[model samples]
Target: MERRKGTIVNVGSITALAPGPWAGVYSASKAALHALSDSLRVELKSFGINVMTVAPGGTKSNLGNSSAAKYDQTHDWKYYKKYEEGLRARTEISQGPGSTPAEELAKKVVASVLKKNPPAWFAYGQFSAILSVLYYAPLWFRDYFYRLVMKC
Candidate 1:
């Protein structure tokens, strides 16, 4: 890496920006990565390395299906039993019809990262805009929106 300048692309999720119900752990992990990327970007700049954080929203992929497979919606719950279906649905939310194709996102990322001046942050895929809005929205508005959408 010291011989030649290169870009380090860190893939995160939109959840890191505006976390919602039933995916706190996942969101938190991604948020950590986002933070790390931000710090690394500055720390590595003097070394001729560019760090780019990619926060993808809902993109078409098997991740959702795989996650849904492992989820046991039938399991007994102590507090969120009433929201079982909603919780399970969280895993499949990104697989919806409007989700962006993974290939499309991949191509964009590749092109962006290869540029002489790559952006520090690149966010794409469905729900990216909405999530960004939620990220900047008032706390009460975000809370109300999530409650209404999650039906919780």
Candidate 2:
């Protein structure tokens, strides 16, 4: 804020770490947000407004089921019908037991925000570690990994 010189936090998704099949648009949007946050972090530094980007991997929520339901209701894939099962599975992949609790992520984010020197980049929750690995892997390896896991 101009008055108080507060922090700006942008919440992105771990999916933005890599561009893969099935969720390309979503990934691109999140990726754009991350980029914007990075730029803002520098541009707003002089104003004493800290910018932080949080890329949550998978927090516990009903998102998976809701996504599946919406996809099933709205999309009737004629040519890509063969990949329907895989697509559906992708929607629910993050709502499993391995996901970090929403409350836990909230607490961590709040704690970080309250800190005098909050982290510029923070990533937490399930699938975050593996996703980071994928992000750092070579392009070829990342492609292979996604092909294998996403059934692309």
lDDT values, one for every candidate:
0.90, 0.87
Write down the lDDT that model 1 would get.
0.90
Off by over 4 Å in 2: none
Encode model 2's per-residue lDDT on 1-152: one tens digit a residue: 55748899999999899767788888899999999999999999888999999999888788777878876566566766788777886887888778888999999999999899999999999988888888889999998887788786
- TM-score of predicted structure 2: 0.92
Which candidate ranks first by TM-score, i.e. highest?
Answer: 1
- Global Cα lDDT for candidate 2: 0.87
At residue 20, candidate 2 shows an lDDT of 70
TM-score of each: 0.93, 0.92
